[model samples]
Target: MSNINPFDKCPVYETINLIFTKVKEEDAIDLFECYSDPITKSRMNNDNCGGVWDTHNIDAVTKGIKGWVQEYNDRFYIRWSINHKQINKIVGTIEIAPVPNTTRFWDGACQTGILRIDIISSLENKIVLSEILRMVSDNFYVDLDIKNIIIKATKDDGERVLALENNSFDKLENSTFPYSDYYIK
Candidate 1:
């Protein structure tokens, strides 16, 4: 595995339909749309992360983006804006961080990465989610040096659950978090 610090120079990933890059101040408008939407706010996984997902204005979104940038500088976690290639707009943000040993996992102990994907409800279909998960599967394991990746998917999110299942992620039965089911790959 490479010992490179991903935070040193943030990595940019691109797939046929999406592009992932470090969140920027300019993304406030597009991101505000996601944050302010009721459906999108309902699907966001805000566990562990201190920030509130829902926002009422562009300033809140801009402040949030600044916080994300600060978090990146501190090497806490890297948040990437998920840009839809066809629309040339940011549809969501994905965060990947090394799972701290303090957090409980199904297995006793293992190297893991915790993934959080917050996207617009309109693009919450299996196809779109599958593509995003595929990009994570293809790159994050090696980049983060983790044996497994875990994500929280609520039972109500049928499309996201299907996408997780289709992308080699299994529902973890013994998750400590009660709000949502955790999936591991």
Candidate 2:
């Protein structure tokens, strides 16, 4: 089989108010701001750190994005920077990968296109979130042949939970499952 990596090529998505582009080493500070936001931190599971997802330290954040570069090269998963088109700043990130084969789905088997949107406190709303999700689905899903995508919502994030539901995500009854909801198209 050929050995080309999925992330070897760059991807960019332009929406009405935002853009999704490749994450880079220079995005360390902006990434830190997104990951460190209290609402962002409180809205998702972050038990695993030691990467760009680490909110407390800039060095850790830098190390994290740098490592994501490596991870991209390795073709394990991919993260894209979410930038405000008008302001020209990264407000969040989205990590996409295959469901790790350990998690259960509606059919009770792991699936591809498991996703996580890590955004700053402010952008966690219906309008922006809907646009981001639409961008990903409309742009990348077919190229990747994604069967399903999932987003985990924190216990206290009622707005996000509602958004997920509105977008047709089925809530996995067992909260202990790594992600709280799943989306199939």
Quick one: best lDDT, which candidate?
A: 1
lDDT by residue (106-131, candidate 1, tens digit) is 22353787898989988989999999
Which digits, one per residue and each the tens of the lDDT, describe model 2 over residues 1-185? Answer: 11333455656779899988879888888988887787787665543333335458888888878877777776666788888988889898887765654432222343556677888888889778888877877755554545667666665677777777677776666544453344443
Candidate 1 lowest-lDDT run of ten: 101-110
Quality of model 2 by C-alpha lDDT = 0.69
176: Cα error in model 2, Å: 11
RMSD in angstroms between candidate 1 and the native structure over all alpha carbons: 3.4
